[model samples]
Target: MMACIQFLLLFCSFMYIFNVNPSCAQIPNSPIRSLVLPVTKDPATFQFLTTIYHGTSREPIRVVLDLGCPSLWLDCSSGRLSSSRRLIPSCSIQCAAAKPNNMSCAFSAAMPTRKRTACGLSTENSIARSATRGELVEDILTVESVDGSKAGPVTTVDHFLFSCAPRFLLNRLARGAQGMLGLGKSRIALPSQLASKFGLQRKFATCLSSSDGLILFGHEPGYDSIFGTEISRSLMYTPLVTSPDGSGSSQDYSINVKSIKINGKRLSLRQKGIGGGTKISTTVPYTTLESSIYSTFIKAYKESATNNYFLNMTVVAPVAPFGLCFSSKEVPSSMLLGPMVPVIDLVLQSEMVKWRVHGRNAMVPVLDEVMCLGFLDGGSKSKTSSSIVIGGFQLEDNLLEFNLGTSMLGFSSSLLTRHTSCSDYHTRMMQSTLKDS
Candidate 1:
């Protein structure tokens, strides 16, 4: 009996050392139900940034939130190096999961001459259109936890996979941002890792604004009430479709836009239906439409503003990026939304499932006295690849939930209409929690 007991003890010790049981590796009975990241928009670049604590020392790293990127990568040359970081072997299971097609080790000038095996990954700067090779590595990642009503304590993921790129890749990104946090539909992306590690739902939500906003991983039922009505109740969902040309594995979130409308009237487009050429992007600053579509859209908007909203509004000289500009005095401002202007709608699967763009989202103030239409004209359908690219400005102050499990995108149009903005919601939540604490 004593020999049997000793044998059992030895077997348990081996299991503990090797982590044979995945459940034994995690923090037992952890109270964290969801993760929250604070999002802030850069004034100069107009790109949104989110903070995440990484490494054993818990270094806070600010990364641009890119909806199109497939993986998370940082500038390792200048960024702090974590002592706990470990490179995944080229032939390991983790490396296979990250890059199944490429198993060969990466070559870097910085690497030692001594032979070693490490997984190679290609990190790309979508803004600069540059690509660099990096090695796959895993380190501790910490994020703020939330339990619905308030922010909880920080939670740590034992092993988070990311690549380390060279410093030059940081060019064209927002100032102070060291990396890009990819929220795309890839296995190695942030949402996938968080969901897998925490056993949470495979969904994430983004709320972007000029000031600090919130990005929540896994649905927080409490946040649904921030808009005065449950956000889910107000949310309208549209099926997320894959890109054309048979690239179903594309990381970007795309939706089918049936038609475009200005002030409840549909615009006459060169193409009858825009179809599956609309995508959501946080990197692009303004909504971009194909040249032909833009021409018809701008003409319809001008007519609507002149005849209905702003009578005899003065048309000012065009801004550099905006083709249509109007005198600020002619446009009326609303306390709830923004400048009172004609609404723009992107009719989705059905007319009733329209993604409405109100005055606040459709207009941008370029000069003190001039406000211009926020939409931009992408040269042609061939050049742009998409008929409509929904950019960050249009997404600001809107709550967008990407449900990967259901392959659906849920959106709440202009939280300002609900008498609250993204920045306001985040500030209110923090203040209320502080008071309670």
Candidate 2:
């Protein structure tokens, strides 16, 4: 009896320590929901989650495996994201079919070297030399099977190209989405090993929405699942959140409005929009959305866009935008809907100074200041130089809100002052006049 009691007690202790609270313990380690990250110039690397889909059946059987680090390379011919790209036929080799050096030889030849230049940007660097009139390059995922011992040769068709890029630049500058996956039947792209090893057979699906339209991923049914690290975690990636189930539901995320102080007066920022939500979008054109408000405020202050004046102050939280995942679309809807992932409202940790303008008099003070930060685009051949690109500044909401023509200047809240009054100028101009008198 004594021995039995000791054993029972030990077992109970073990269970308690593990918190074998079946309900919470049952939750899979993988995030049920897939987060949409903001478009990044570099790449994301990590040991995240993976879901496998079979081409013929179009189903998701499992999603829990380790995808080693993957690289998302830019398609030089067209400035867009790409996983394992096609080899230029010219790069083909004469290796006998028996030896099968096709994949190796082809990849070596087509991979952009520091020597190639396309569209004014070096194919080697992949960064746009001058902003072009084409599609915005977005996410580039490279997937490989972790279970290499069991699989045969991986096929080229096994790769995928998801269409997700900025729409405005699509026709003007973006490369035509080269052989993008059609959401048609029986087409497959996810690396085969993920299916065989992880038991992930269902084709996971999601829509990257934007002002443009909904973008389907996993290609209707067949799609490529690049195995490896995401580009953002590896480079300069902004943060973002995902729905709990990876369902892409808007309700799953958070958005916060910290404080709204107008002209040194505090106002409870609790106004709701049409849907009883915090944010509302007007059909107004981008240029006009804030133009009229800005104009009215500046004109009243007798200033120009160059002049710093009136502002609407708002504090924001930080969340990663999702649009960064797809770069192959002629006009990826992600550009419209994915980039703004209410990080501010969702996290509610940090505060951002919003430069808002209401009707007339400079309600908010103008903080004239400049700052310099660092930018890192790791893909550049020169890693050191690529790490410090001299970015911009940032502003806070103490007494003023900072802004430029329409750019995110930076995060510095330092202010600049002007001595426009003749009296103020004369004080500096004629210090001797006052002393002599």
Candidate 3:
């Protein structure tokens, strides 16, 4: 009995081990102060979202951390959630009916893009619209976080407002995230609501890599605490600007980029005479390059490679929607020989920041050898006045922080030296330690 007790004590010690993988670059001096889990990258779809546990029963629901969206939603039609209501249209008599007790009521969600047209008249004296059906529920939602008291603690939000989507045209990509957790500037969004409810600051950070990273809360215990003092001071920061058109769509993390360079050759994309027109953008799910900018970028890329290769080895005329296509066998492992792609630098006037999107993030791997540019074309002129929309692919290893308190968008190089995550390393140690004991 004494031996067994000793074994139990030894096993508990192993469970707390972290970053056991020596290959990891920089281990956080302390445990990370965030709720983090490995993301689900649908290899077939290139979706970098994760499913989370929510509701009273803690049912699993896949959600996207979308800054572009303004609310949290779940798919009830999937049959995963048991308590959900389908709302009736205002034009119908059921709309004036009394609220149901104990049961949550579903309603037509206001899709900003579609206002008045966002509803439907039910046939049984009511009609539910196509993409706007959902519910407003008050329940306890749980989130796992590091409380400084222990390694992991449950964050419960009582009477939280979220949606239940009964009908939202979910395709291969949209279906990847059954619900969307809005990180936008809107107060109704999850982050803002989470902060206001808990009296915590509205600052959050995400170190999202392909493997494992964390979504941290409360600025006090985040990067500043996790990173050593010297390392924290060296981080780069820029103002989180609003939409160029002053549309007040606070979702975009905008910055003024001066020019783009390849091998130090400024791509002649600078502002010409009196007025300038260069905007590089990165938004959630995509990083977009202006039409002319992308064309010039591709041309320069082709000239830089040996044998004047654009997307080398791969052949086939450029297809619709995509201009540059490459054969699977022909592409190099990285255009970036080091921290940057061979010699590409995106020069920004904000703080004279020269950000480099590593080759791994710049060129997305579609399949075996098939690769495509990670950026999309938002036409020569975007209706929103944004020339470029910075997307997810370009943010691979970087840790991005959107701090409302400081009104700054800060970023730093990958905390992990290599690709392996701390969580994976910890799990492996637990498994091995148990076996040896």
The C-alpha lDDT values of all candidates are 0.80, 0.21, 0.50
Clashes of 1: 0
Task: Name the Cα RMSD for model 1.
Answer: 6.8
Q: List model 2 lDDT by residue over 1-437, tens digit each.
A: 65564444444433332223454232324312111111101112111122222233322222211111011122234332234333222211211111122233233554455113211211111112222222212222322221111111122113232222233322211223211221111111222212222223322322111111111122111211111122111221112222222332221111222333333333322341111111111110011112222223223222221132322112222112210111111211122122111111111224333433221111111122211010111222121111111111111110110111121112111111111211222132234333433
Which parts of model 3 have CA positions greater than 4 angstroms off?
1-38, 80-135, 147-151, 172-176, 224-233, 271-286, 306-322, 325-341, 366-372, 413-437
Q: By TM-score, is 1 or 2 better?
A: 1
Query: Which has the greatest lDDT?
Result: 1
What are the runs in model 1 whose C-alpha is more than 4 Å off?
Answer: 1-28, 101-115, 220-222, 225-229, 247-249, 270-273
Residue 269 CA displacement from its true place in model 1, Å: 1.9
TM-score of 3: 0.67
Lowest lDDT sum, 10 consecutive residues, model 1, at 102-111
Candidate 1 vs 3: which has more lDDT = 1
